[model samples]
Target: MNTLRIQTRDGRRTDISADTLATLTATLRGRLLTEDAPGYDAARRIWNGMIDRKPALIARCLGASDVVAAVNFAREHELLFSIRGAGHNIAGTAVADGGLMIDLIEMQGIRVDPEARRVWVQPGTTWADVDRETQLHGLVVPGGIVSTTGVSGFTLGGGFGWLTRKWGYTVDLLRSVELVTPDGQFLNVTAESHPDLFWALCGGGGNFGVVTGYEFDAKPLGPTVMAGIVFYSFERAVDLLRHFREITGNAPNELACLFAVRTAPAAPFIPEEQHGKLIVGIAMNYAGPLDDAMRYVDQIRNFDAEPIVDLIRPQQFMEHQKFLDAGQPYGRNYYWKSDFFDRIDDELIDVAVDHWAQITSPLSSSLIMHLGGAGQARPLDSTAVGFRNTEFVFNMQSAWDGDAGSEEHIGWARAMFDAVHPYSGGSSYINFQTEDEGDERVRQSYPAEIYERLVEVKDRYDPTNMFCFNKNIQPSAAVLRRQRADTSPVSD
Candidate 1:
């Protein structure tokens, strides 16, 4: 190891001697990587190819002990650090430029207690990992639609997926979390234990601490589910979407559906002639009995114009989780803008359709997910997740091959976001927010009271703002004042 220049918590640069770096390396059970390290390049890369940050050091944590060592080292040195799970966040907040990168990707572990209907997952575990284990017993944890999404970041940022309507947001199923605080204390947090901290962890983002493990109350779902996509011609999108809004409004809790507009991909299920043509798709998952699911499928099939492709069928739950994974592969250039909507009205549909026509990239898409069932039944203040009354979420995803057309694709997504924002309920999904959507946009993710409460928790647990990499919530003035007033040294 050599001397390294790293960023500090106060936005200043400082150098650490080789001996100091060696001390940190020796304390870790996992390997530590510097810029010159053989695998450093691949270690720092995240899901979004648009992000190209170079961290000064990377700690590949293997377990809770390694996390504690890394946290203590960073705290003692007053170093700025970011945490990486599966690196699936669109904002690319998992990697910090010229700072310590706590790489948790190697800590994937999951234990399922099927009889108790619960599971404990490591921070690095992806939804696919959890699904693989839980599905053996016909159980599942509410997780993201993409199989590769990290369990920790997704649940902390308010997870939504095909099972959301039936099981509620992922946070709603959380039983407890084992966390390493900024000051180096490891504690198991739960609603019955540290109620305030536990509440903040639910949709509060990663402002408070580094989560080592998550315990969730799993639901009995299936080894097989009736789930797939039904694609329609773009010409009939307006009529089809209006009908989509009607049926979804009355959709049962067991039926979860999402509407999307994008170019058709070349797949066996899609006709070769329709390849590259723009279309609207209604993707659905019915978690109940097979016979009951077909009735809702009939409603979608009854639209005036015939569907260009209807591939709805019985599929393994794990297979359904990977349905959209191909389109959002790692290293793709992705930018997104999103908001919550109370209704999918005519005016909102018109704005969405107009923006859909100007999509700059074939891989880009506009999506509206119907989102009011079991999730909405929870009280608004029950957890850090607000906007429970939200009927749908609108996400404009801009994706392209490389940097040449970055501006054009991002512009299309922004234009559509600005146009459809009028129909929004003045809140947003934190996970879908892009890197450039500044602090004010993050504030928009929660209600006024909820944001204030999150700040309080952040102040209490992370007074110095050590974890400012994610959708950050700064500490209160009083907390900083107390820290400055006390001249006592920080304990390791």
Candidate 2:
């Protein structure tokens, strides 16, 4: 493979020798793919259609040592590097342009300790893998709504999911992480060890290091849960959405709901006439008893008309998790923006409905997730996750078939965000960010003090910023000055 020699984006020729490539390949038990490999195209593909970058090489890491060797090789050769977990990042940062990619897809290992109620999962594993493993003991950890999302990116960005209200963000359950630093030193990060790194990983995204695995605190949950959708037409959206806001505000922690506005899919439960019509749908998942949970949700039936579908009933956790899977598949052009709101007022509802009526694609949709109970109760500084106390967090997304319709869908998403920006909390969720947003939005994702701390940590761990593909935190000059002034030494 001639060490995958290539020209950089700035037109500089860089080279790695054939012997170095052989040494790198032998470091891992898995395969190292180059341009000549048959799986190169499949390995480079990500979840979004908008991302099209071809890496010089893709190293499928089998274990921790493989990750360390890859990092060291990239640093030594001055090659740009990227890390791939489940390859589901909407921003498409998982793959780089003409760089070396360390693909963790071969490291799908999960160990569940039922007595301790904890689970250790490797980066390549998906949420569906974790849910299935933990459910055997009637236990589960909080994860994203989409089962395909990677645990590494999801938890790093303070994961919010179907059980957020009851269990808190996915970062809240994170007990420890195994990471390889930019300098290729491996460290186990947790509250008791490398506490600063632990804080930075919670919501800082994958800016600091390549996390190989995560140890999470799992909770005792159900083999069965009460969940399903309650669909309503767009005509009653304003009233029904406002009513939903009021109810979730006072609802118990075990109850969680999401308000989605999209064209109704052709499901057996929905009438065929409404297949392409815009509708306001409530996706509910309650972890408590079925009869009591239904009591609080029965008020939804009192709307002006009968719902197009009411599938709320007792079902297994896996069944409810799989319900939303069919709508979201791989290789679609996706654009998403997220923010938090203190309330869903009539003004905000009006803005949402207007955008809903003009939706340009079937896959386009918006989500308003309630943030109360367990989610709101966390201390602001308990972890690096910012905007924890907001009343609700909402995400706006636009998905379409191909590039022909991209501009129209992207324009609508931006307009919808602008209309509701005034009502939104200043910060945004890190996982939903787009590449065009630049550095400012990344800074806002964390609190000011926490962001400063993250920069200091960046100076200590990744001083050269080898992992600059993510939402970066550049070390400040002041931090360097403080480090010089203080003669205290720390160990890795």
Candidate 3:
């Protein structure tokens, strides 16, 4: 490794030249901390507790130039490199062991253009920041359900939230992205120019490159919207869930809802007795006129079952994002498995009910999001986001105690996913994918033609397979042959 001629933020490597260190320092307006630095340990922390990788250098990138410099430095030495946008990925690819991490946490700039109904954002900024800024102009970007999720990663991996059923995924609204390629070049990619790269980044995860900033088309939204949770007993969960699915599919675009089976928490709204009980709750976000939203949701609210709690009402969209935020805290280990369903059938409902009975941790919850309407209208070729044909996204999460209970929770999730997979559209949301699995799984996530196009784009940008950490698609010569054959058919 001594002959590697590596670059270091500090004096860890004796082979690094003084000139290279000086150039690196000039690139970062902020501090570049090495492994031996005072805050090195704290800076490397990520959302998932299971990931404990330690990077050699944590460059707190001040601007795009810093990112470019970091990429080159890592490439020059052949050292492993990783990009940290929001570091909220459950897969924990943001931080790699003994590699370089280009931390973008300092780049939290957001500018809203109300007249144009668009917003420019830095990768470091979160959904909460976007909402807070855009709400000043009565606008919003369709983002992740959690406000704290980073725009860079969330948008890259296909963001779906309260506004998803209404406005489609976040990538649908992206107008442009400013990114630094793995080869140390800065480019502005969009529909008109470098369209392939732009398409790959949409749902390509972080495989293509590090996106420094994004320009998004914002939509008119609410500072206050009708949203909250409506709880039902476990015994009636199947009936309630079936009805919930139907209502959500037929409901107005403004009305977005997710059904969850979780251990009831000791919140003030729930009765003291119901605390710790297995319960099914329909969480909702209605983005249109409150009266109309209420009218649309009345069918579910008016159900005959005596409800334990009805906390649904008009509140700030920001508040709605924060409602479940407290429940999902940092440090508890998380393992997730997801299935995309074309329709919610009775067989699937039975599987859900069977698993709902065995949920051991209060943090463990299963989520079923309604997908369709505006979701399916987006052209398959518009972005690399997969599972466009599916109408529902289901996640089986198991957040348990220590390593001892790992097998139990994981088994349950796998079993539940397997049982209902027959109804799945042979695809899943890439963001929620835990195991890298294989190329076939990734291919299944997207339509066949779109997957091949993405492979071509990946070959163009990352030919050497440097950014193969995420759901990777290595472009083979065979793929090129087919592409050429398709384009070069008989011209007589």
Candidate 4:
């Protein structure tokens, strides 16, 4: 093969000569895929159907060393590059157009130290992998409702889930990270060793570098827990929400719940008459003892005005983690808008219902994730993830099948987001950022002091802005100028 042409970091044409490419390929244990290589297309596919980026090359990294080599290659050539774990990220930023993609899907390895109560995982590992291992030891790591979501992106972007109320955000439980810096050096970062890098990596997307491994402090919980759902007609949504507000005001930390307004799916549990009809659902998971969690089941049912179906029962924790899988399957076009609130009062409730009435597709949903307890007990500055005071995290999620008429679905989601924006905390969630959201949205997501600190870290590790595909935090102008001044003239 001739020299492989590619785009550089500065958006210009470049080439990795055949010999260079062969040498690079030999240095790694994994395959280096070019545009025409077998499995290249499949390797580039992500969970979101909307993103259709075709990278110039794909690095199918099988392990940590492969990631290191790929990072080094991209840096040495100044090639524009991206990193992919499970490719389940909502924004689909893992694959870049005409750039190098470091695919880590083959690196999905997990190790649990039941004695030490810690779990070490590779970036490509999904939450289900961790849950399966940890739950076997009668313990759990706080993760998302969907089992298939990748652990690295979620944790790095400040994850929240059923156990979030008890164990705090996923970043809170993170003990250390094994990252390959922009310069292609392996670093074992922790609070005690590389505090600055550690702090930034906690919730700071993949802005600094590519993380190969993550270690988190696991919590002892369950192989089984009390978890279920309650359904009600859309007419009673307001009433149910009002009652929910009262419960959330004083609900126990062990109990985590989510309130969603959407058209009910035609599941056997749902009455055939109510299929495809609008309804309000409360998805609850009680990590505490079944005997104790039993008391709150009826209490939750009472919140609904005219209860339609109550599937609340005790089931395996793993099954509970997989509950939302049906609602969010692969290959769906997904656009999300999100915000946090100190409370979910009538004003927000009305706006949510009003928007739910405009849902363009049956797959779309309006949801409010109840957040409190340990996630809020800690101070805001303690971690890179902010929004400590938020009691409810609201999301307008739009998902649909096929490409035809997708524009209108996206427009509907954006409109609903606009209506609910005024009631928000004037900030956005980094994880929920869509491709349309710009740099300003990124800056406002963090506090002034925090954003500046993140900039400082960016300057120190990735001064040239190599990792700009994510929710990027650009290096300050002063740092760029300093680098220029520090540069020595070459006169060999």
Candidate 5:
């Protein structure tokens, strides 16, 4: 029966009586965690090892009703709160210091409609979870490359993966979402039902509300497909990169490839001497029929020079989705800088190669993900997703074992990002942004019209700016002024 001191939306601290706290806890079917609670520390630990935050209260939500309770409590108290799904975001915005943390990790639910080729997924469900059920009927939802990524954050922030070239970004597959607004109203939002809200959520990054469930249009792809990676010597990085760009430029919708420059891992497929040495790799997924996929695979296999390791072959689609999982294990310190590219010119390629040679950590890498195909075919105004006409995405990902050498690793990523930014399309992916990138970086993530439109949506649904943690989009000043005026006392 201890009284609690929680942070308010305006950054002031306020005390809540034990009775009040107990009332909220009692209404929840899930548990409410205080600082001294048994699982508080474990619940706060997220995928990134660098973030160490402590929320005043953690509401472990078990279902939509639990989410409703938490949202209502926070709104009534005017408490600052953050939402956590799988806690996999690199920015670590899920847990707010001294504020309420709506932990949705326990709400893992997935219902698939085989006949409709659709899925209704709970916020806590990960790409791996969704894939498991969808693949039961040989259907799939386009999701993030990392299997551990949460469906909620990934979908809200414009998700893409191996199937992106064929199916489009994850948001494109979204049919509807079940949301709990800042004011505690539950809404099942769809394009036809709530056009503005739906557009804002497509790539808006959790700025509007807490989404409990996502309904996605799933497409049939694979029980098995031709996919894997090919490793080459770093000495031929320029030529290999050019080859990768050339082939990908002419690639069909079913073929997607990512070019990476990093040190090789000590896997059995690679030569012992080549392990831990710098190398360039082309990881590919060809989702069409096996017969047609082999033709594209053969072209890479027969490139001018022999590959150091060739692991490309037919594999289960789920296995292909998890190809990068080992490299992105949870609790590892990670820093990322990303942007979209209109084209991979020689200058950008050289800059990336130069930065690759100066890599501070063995776990760090520079990635060039080929874009276009189905994604580009969609109009720029079709959804809130930014930079549709771009040809590729470049990400400078820095991963290290611990907190040691953090400066060196981060500095390297920033330096690389700066060198290659001039070649960028001037917009970046919201999902890849880091915590320190600031509000301007967020504004740059969308087009001028799209950013302004997102703000209008925010003004309408979240005028108080209750959810300001993720790449925040603030409510308009006019709306705020009107709200203040309406709440002011009447004259005598």
Candidate 6:
């Protein structure tokens, strides 16, 4: 009489027999855990604290085969399911209420081929794991700044990081990805093989299937590079912002900088008195010659506006990758509203600082990131990550603790985005958006033609749209037509 209560995507309830569950668990090389099992609560948790969902069961996948088995089991049961890679997605997509969850945390394995400048990465691995291994050969795979973010989601969602100016988004370097589609079939997709699916995976999030591994065309980089931070008083916020623009405007491809208006945290480098004070500064990393890297930030380094503290210097590649980790601790409620920018003019600066002035939570901050260089050189058709022409990106990143004050924090982020919406180019980064933004924003972020193409690919691989989560892309018109044709009354 050991039955599991489960909910389907259509909001129907069903019970799974203990015998059926045992059979599925036996098929997997991995173990299956029920809600009452040890570690089930922890396994169901994700990065964003606001997401507190409990799946009825967790299938902790050990390898690609385990993923395939889990997918088939869930599909057979018609159980609502979610795929958890690193469990770092801000949308809390890793788990759904009373559903089945395929957890990939146990599958972190990385193989680096330095000579070929390629790396084979399993989905559960993080950027930190890749950097630790890739840096051993003086090679780098362009990844997100937060080292904890999983490789699969970030790369598939168009990853951009400190090295983007010098190299490109992580997807640009992708050679192939191994995925288990909604049909429970494992297919290795690349630009040459299954080009359409490959295109969709470049930035389409998790609509088509569950990705198991990725093969990347990694680039040679540094074990040590010139990278660091500088903090300035908010009194000179405008001047500091102006300097930031000038520095990144015509900057060399080897330099990538991030400017922000944040309340100074109590770090050793920041003065005790300045802690909690509104401030502005730029965090920079140089992927070029060490000497040139030194000369790169010299202007701002010696500016008359004066930096309250400057820590820019040559450091290990690893240090800069996780530079912002402190501010983005796990279990904190997080919300981010983002936009694309053609330039950072005076008006935009004023708008950003105004929002910064009204920030209710000390953890909330505004980020202006420089875009372009080698990444811009790539053709628009090279991948699905459109809007490569933009010169900048705006992010109003908000983080607040506990539920009591969540509204106040999210309100600040939304208001800030609205104030600067007119300045935006009518597009945004999909990965930075919250789940509430929904399908419309997902469709609007890409060109109409590009989005339609994504739908077509979704139609081809997952006609029923089983993977309908995480900034989902619905199946195209053709898929609906075929489904109707198959189900319609037929004459003899």
Per-residue error for 197 in candidate 2, Å, reads 0.9
Q: Give the TM-score comparing model 4 with the true structure, all chains together.
A: 0.97
Candidate 4 lDDT over residue span 9-101, tens digit each? 778979779999999889889999998899988888998988999999899998879988999899889898888988997788898899999
User: What's the number of clashes in each of the models?
Assistant: 0, 0, 0, 0, 0, 0
Task: Show where candidate 3 strays beyond 4 Å.
Answer: 1-23, 401-404, 435-438, 477-492
* TM-score of predicted structure 2: 0.95
Off by more than 4 A, model 4: 484-492
Clash pairs for candidate 3: none
Tens digits of per-residue lDDT for model 3, 78-147: 6666788877777777887766788998899999999999899998888889999998988989887878
Candidate 5: deviation at residue 245, Å?
A: 0.9
lDDT of 6 by residue, 1-492 (tens): 289999886679789999998888889898899988888888888889888998988999999899999989878887888888898877777788889988998899999988898999998899999999999999999998788888877887888988888888888889999999888899999888898999999988888888999999888787889988898999888888888888987689999998977889898878899999988888898998898887787965856766888889888989888888888888899988899988887898898787788888898877888879888888876778866767788888889887778888899999999998888877666777786898888887788877888988887888877887577888977787788799789989
- lDDT tens digits, residues 1-492, model 5? 599999998889989899999999899999999999999999998999888999999999998888999999998888999999999998999989999999999989999999999899999989999999999999999987789999989999888889989988888999999999888889999999999999999999899889999999999978998999998999999999999988897899999999988888898888999999999989999979999998898877767877998878899999988988888899999999998888889998888899889999999887889888898888887788877778899999999996799999999999999999998878988779898988898899889999999999999999978899888898988988998899899999
Once model 5 is optimally superposed onto the true structure by TM-score, how far is the C-alpha of residue 208 displaced, in angstroms? 1.4
Give the runs in model 2 whose Cα sits over 4 Å from its true position: 6-13, 477-492
Q: Measured by C-alpha RMSD in angstroms, how accurate is candidate 3?
A: 5.5
Q: What TM-score fits each model?
A: 0.97, 0.95, 0.91, 0.97, 0.98, 0.97
lDDT score of model 5? 0.90
**TM-score of candidate 1 relative to the true fold:** 0.97
- Residue 275 of model 5: what lDDT? 93
Best first by lDDT, ranked: 5, 1, 4, 6, 2, 3
Model 1: clashing residue pairs?
A: none
C-alpha lDDT of residue 222 in model 6: 78
Candidates 1 and 6, the one with greater TM-score: 1
Quote the positional error of residue 311 for candidate 1 in Å. Answer: 0.8
Q: Which portions of model 5 show Cα errors greater than 4 Å?
A: 484-492
The predicted structure with the larger TM-score, 3 or 4, is 4
